[model samples]
Target: MSLPHTPLERVTSIKRKLIILIGVAVGATIAVFYVGVKLGAWPGIAGALGGVVALAAVWFLARGLTRPVREMAHAANLITRGDFDVRVSAESRRDEIGALARAFNRMAVELGETDRLRRDLVANVSHELRTPITALQVHLENLVDGVESADPETLQTMLDQTIRLGRLVEQLLDLSRLEAGVVPLDIRSFDVETMLQGAVRESRLVRPGGAIAVRVDPTGLQGVGDAERLHQVIANLVENALRYSPTQSAVEVRATKTHEAVVLEVLDEGPGIAPGDAERVFERFYRSDAARSSEMGGAGLGLAIARWVVDLHGGSIRAEARDPQGCRIVVELPTAIGAA
Candidate 1:
């Protein structure tokens, strides 16, 4: 219904400004020729009309050529203003600007994702802190009001909550130091099965009567890293598996040595990660579909720390959907030099 404007004209870009400027100049020249034609200069008027048509073509070409750059600048401004959702399409272009535009879009997506994760972190942390603090507060209040007898069991429950809060804070601090590169790794060659068994022991100690198992292949495999830290990684994963799994279900840890690396897996019979959520499980404060109540869910720092530990050892870690039902988290670490 309306033919006055083109898509290029709708956007405020450098190219659009050039089109307007050139159009104004060409329009003025055409106006002068039209006056000459009114004075009986028909030949000049015809030449002026041809020039006007040429200028319009130039404007259209300019718009087409500079549109991606305009989109790039616009997207940059939006990102600087804390908006990361804007994107520029550069898929078909083969120019340098096209590559830059594609890079810009990638940055925007990563930033948007980071922002969303930050929001979730705040929310989850608030909930985690509130749960333990509220419990402690209630226990103290009961004592103050003399509403309940100050039994040893009540005292012990309050103390346990206090310890849990302290542990969460400590884990947060540890993660921060790790990310800041303040925590150094003590790499050493040792049997990784020791770490695996330690983690299983920890899981059973914390959850008595829980089904936990470990299987190591080909006698054993030597792993190189901070055995203590690797121990922490295995424990974190095993604990998480135990947390999500049904009480009587078995949680298994398996380690197999390949030619160049050793692969470790933690398998649980919990509701598996939904499609596409496998990688995100390593993100801080990110809980899968498994019910992460205050009593069961940790501070959400364990997997994040585990990821860092694996990365430091030149390893890769990921979660996969298990067969039938549940999730399997796998970690692969390079074998230590000269390690058996």
Candidate 2:
């Protein structure tokens, strides 16, 4: 008996394959025995010939069942050696081996993505840390060598760089804690309008001339969750808006209540995010404009932190393009009853 090397056999169900294998082996044995006996060969010789014929039939008929398993073993070895690009031919088989191959492909994709993110994180962190450190070092060197005097202006510039470095480090730590779930939420019901107002006031204090505004529809709306964390989310959004907005343009913070959730929005009169980057902007260390953000002392973690906080509170956040030119970020949090 001969096995046909065709894809149809691979797509056939394993049960059918097994049935065919047993049928072929038994039929081949009987045929060989009958031919040997009709040719006047000894009974023992005929039986031995029948056994050899049966073994050959079984081996040929079973290759399809074992080929995929062999391929998977080889692929697994490659994966262990850090070769995520290796893949087995699933051949569209409707069997367990096919399913396993598909799942293995998915896992390889995920592992490759995770490795890429890890590498990006390391590189971005190093770059972020170096910028401020280099600036501070240059300033200190100038002062020590008498290249520049330790006047109030020079000292203030040095202090600003130091503060930026400290802020970046603190944000990194906060993000780490949030991702690890080590920071517990202080969940409770609080006034959404008041919180928005406080965030606006704080932004106002930080940039006295920035145009920031807050509005709550059906005023005195309340929300359920960690007040402080929610405040951080709002503050980060407002600050992000202000950073890109034109000096004379307003950054509007709005809150409205719906049947399902409490919706908060921040709108800015700045260049809007491109459609492709709307989602990626929330990724850690991902900046739409790296040079501009660095000049603004942004370590590209504000939106990332805000996303983490919103996620922890069982909320959703997204970026939108404001009409006539600008950007809007929307956050929706579970209401008290919904949260419960």
Candidate 3:
């Protein structure tokens, strides 16, 4: 592609044109004065002065148009040098060049955000993968050196660690697919009560001794969504609750109908999220201080995946502090009329 003219070149061209015009007018005026002096006419000098004034007006007009062009070129050069902070302030004009400058500024902002996210992704993924790998290596080394024998419990512990690693990998893959827009939702109408019941039953299996409650309104509430994906969303939330809450503490899964949507909440009697972590908790590989050090069998992508599934169904999910203590995760999906 051909490169466009730089602002400096444009300014130089305008200056050159002004000089040439001035020189031509002066030469013509000299020629006229010489002829007029020979012919005894005095008006030729006045005509030449008028030509000079007209040339000055043209020069000013050229400068007026090129000012923004120069500023835009400088901003472009800064951006080319990887300076995302460069901004063009000439957005007031309605011309094509003004629109181009606005678009360039917007692109720089997006590129900056993408770069930050890329750095965060690399750091978080490295940290997450390192933990499980390091644990597995230590255990294997102990067994090899006879520090710990291959007892049944020791074998089982190794098996659990390996399984945790597999699960983490699987979650990462799922999140990647979700983000890539390759996971299509299988939309259908399903009763919310049945879904919650299944999730609560499954959660009980995971935390056998934990006290859990499932509360749903008698009037059936229904919603349109991908049943499998929605089930995963609920299961992940409940599993998260069970993993964090103190053993024997009550975990509640409740569903209620609002005017336009059905709200399903998973509430746990655990230490609530820290003040600044409520939003970040849903990010992939993010963990609050209380859960970060624990050997929780998750890669911290559960909430992120849940949010994606809910968003696919045009719904919302958020974390809130429960009354007195603990955290409540609320999921809201639009209810289908006359569906049970």
Best by TM-score: 2
Q: Write the per-residue lDDT of candidate 2 for residues 56-88, one digit (tens) a residue.
A: 878866666777778889988998898888777
Native-to-model Cα distance after best TM-score fit, residue 260 in candidate 1, in Å: 1.8
Best candidate according to lDDT: 2
Q: Please, what is the whole-model Cα lDDT of each candidate in the order they appear?
A: 0.78, 0.83, 0.77
Candidate 2 error regions (>4 Å): 1-19, 34-40, 290-294, 336-340
Model 2 alpha-carbon miss at residue 199, Å: 2.1
Q: TM-score for each prediction?
A: 0.67, 0.87, 0.77
Instruction: Please list all clashing residue pairs in model 2, or write none if there are none.
Output: none
**Considering only N, C-alpha and C atoms within 3 Å, which residue pairs clash in candidate 1?**
none
Better of 1 and 2 by lDDT: 2
lDDT of 2 at 14: 72
lDDT of 3 by residue, 27-99 (tens): 6666655666667666666566546665665454444455667877897788788787887765544455557
Cα deviation at 182, candidate 1, in Å, is 3.4
lDDT by residue (tens digit), candidate 1, 1-340: 1123343444345555566667765775676567667777787666677577656666664555666677788878999999988888753454465567768878999999989877877787788889889999998999999986799999999998998899888888888788888888887888878889987887677666467778888666777778898888888888888877788888889999888888899998878778787887788877655545434677767889899888878788998888899889999988863342
- Return the lDDT, model 3, position 41: 61
Regions of model 3 farther than 4 Å from truth: 1-56, 64-82, 92-94, 145-147, 293-297, 336-340
